[model samples]
Target chain A: MNQEIRDGLRAAVPVIISAAPFGVLFGALAVDNGLSVFEAVTMSATVFAGASQMVGIELFGQSIAPWLIVFSVFAVNFRHVLYSAAIGRRMVSFTPLQKGLSFFLLTDPQFAIAEARYEAGHRLTFRWYATSGLALYVFWIAETWLGALFGRLLPDSHALGLDFLLTIYFLGLVMSFRKRALWLPVVLASSVASIIAFNVVGSPWHVSLGALAGILVAAAAPLEGVREDEANEGRADA
Target chain B: MSDGTTLLVILGAALATFATRAGGHLVLSRFRSIHPRVEAGLNAVPAAVLTTIVAPAAFNGGVAELGALAVAALASLRFGMTTLFAAGAVTLIGLRALGL
Candidate 1:
């Protein structure tokens, strides 16, 4: 394998390792929320968005409207639209089949790594991207199954603080971007908006509104010339 | 909901979510020459949206606990602790010990 591919896979392994426990926590929560083991694993396999799956399971437990549950999942995952755009540009020269396969594996961490690689003038072949995706895919399925089976043996996750994993994941992402001061206000504003929306509107809608508000605010804010230059360089690589 | 019905619904929702993600790529692939500005904006969207979702949950779980977590987050950042799990673990343990 070329050095670029080797480096990409190496960079991705640590991320996949970190993601394993989060997957297990999701599996435990899925069953605890009253999903059957089969249903839980199926969701992990097919849906693949951890936070959305958790939200869907919670809404299911509450016996919410099916359409509302679907909408909520979409809202939570709407960021994938952005992921698609970014990844799509990188794979723009690939055949439709290759593009389609890569798109299926897109997720937050994968996108972050892929975008960074592309920006650094690294060549991301289909095989490299697929390898990262496949690793994560296997880890997610296996961890979910384990969590569902062992959930009964484990203590209450919320009490044990496993519930905090999702927050930790987000904070890590934010900390990684600490050099970009613009993100600070954008994140803070979106969070405050969501909390207010939660009080006024409620569960699913709050998430959607808060996210939309954040994206709009961030997109509107002017980036420093250096940030813009970096973004342009990343874009040029695609 | 009955077991059979719930199973059907969960499966259906899972398929729908997958389609939404897959479908975006399927459709967008046909287009050529997407605007550079749009592409740049989209690149930043995932991190921004994720931050919005995570920040409130970290700080707003409960007021006192939120304060404890803030302290932990600051400490973690100050010490250049790169692992999020470490920061979160410390905050949770500290809060419990403080009787919050």
Candidate 2:
């Protein structure tokens, strides 16, 4: 391939590696969730958001209202809006089509990779962004396909705790918060709100409710000298 | 849901996701500055969402579930993300088998 694709692929290594199992797990679970192979793979291919897709698939299994599923997906993905602004301004020369593709492929790993590279002072290239994004984009779809085909081979994924892997991953994510004082309160507040939302209010709304609580608390908290760049770092999912 | 609705659901989600990704880039491509508070709020989303997923399960889940969560957390911190999964499922199952 060309230099851009290679560079992009190289940069995507950690993301691809980390995401592979999760992708596979998602695929297997999609099957378990009663999605046909076509539907499962298609969702991964098109929707291209892992966590939200998980939410969508779960709601789909429960046969929740489609709009609620869509809403939950939106709620999970709303973070991308903030992600786009952080990375988009850097792609000043990108055409409208590129803009469309950039967001189509906008995801946590690609965003995280690009954010890390740019923050380190490497000049951000549309090529690098596009290539790396595409690398992840394709791998996610392919692996999901593999997962679905082989999903039945695995024992009950939930019984095996496959579902909790992402949650575990996220818990590890909390350790990344170097601002010790801040993260504790944010987590505590989020936990309380999430539990309340999970129990009293409704289903899956807990995820969004908890997250919003964290955001609101974080916004009002004293994060002196906190810059726009710092915000980009923590925006990726586990 | 019918086949059409299922398709619509997927399509709707894809569209909504694409909008979020593209919308911000389209709007912000014209600018150089972002408000620090807005930035901070965005930054907090990931962690907050993560806590939403982890806290509930770890706190409210059964003995096997709780044991699995503890294993996942300790393993992840010690071995790192490269270890690839929560490893809690097996642990949780094992704990249950042991009558924990």
Best by DockQ: 2
lDDT minimum window of 10 residues, candidate 2 chain A: A229-238
Could you give the C-alpha RMSD of every candidate to the true structure, in order shown? Answer: 4.8, 6.2
Each candidate's interface RMSD (Å, one decimal) is: 4.3, 5.7
Give the distance in Å from residue A144's predicted Cα in candidate 1 to where it truly belongs: 1.8
| Share of native interface contacts recovered by each model | 0.32, 0.63
Compared with the true structure, all predictions reach lDDT values of: 0.67, 0.74
Question: Please, what are the lDDT tens digits per residue for candidate 2 over residues A111-140?
Answer: 656655565466777798898998888999
TM-scores for all candidates: the values are 0.75, 0.70
lDDT by residue (B1-100, candidate 1, tens digit) is 6677766666666666656556656666665544344443555555566665565575468743465456556754765323444666667756665667
After superposition, the stretches of candidate 2 with alpha carbons farther than 4 Å from their true spots are: A1-36, A51-76, A85-99, A108-132, A147-151, A179-181, A226-238, B1-9, B25-32, B63-80, B83-100
Taking the tens digit of each residue's C-alpha lDDT, what string does model 1 give over A102-200? 776787777766765675576777877877777788889999999899976765555555655546655555555555435666567667877787677
Q: Which stretches of candidate 1 lie over 4 Å from their true place?
A: A1-22, A32-35, A59-72, A116-123, A156-160, A179-185, A204-207, A221-238, B1-8, B23-37, B62-88, B94-100
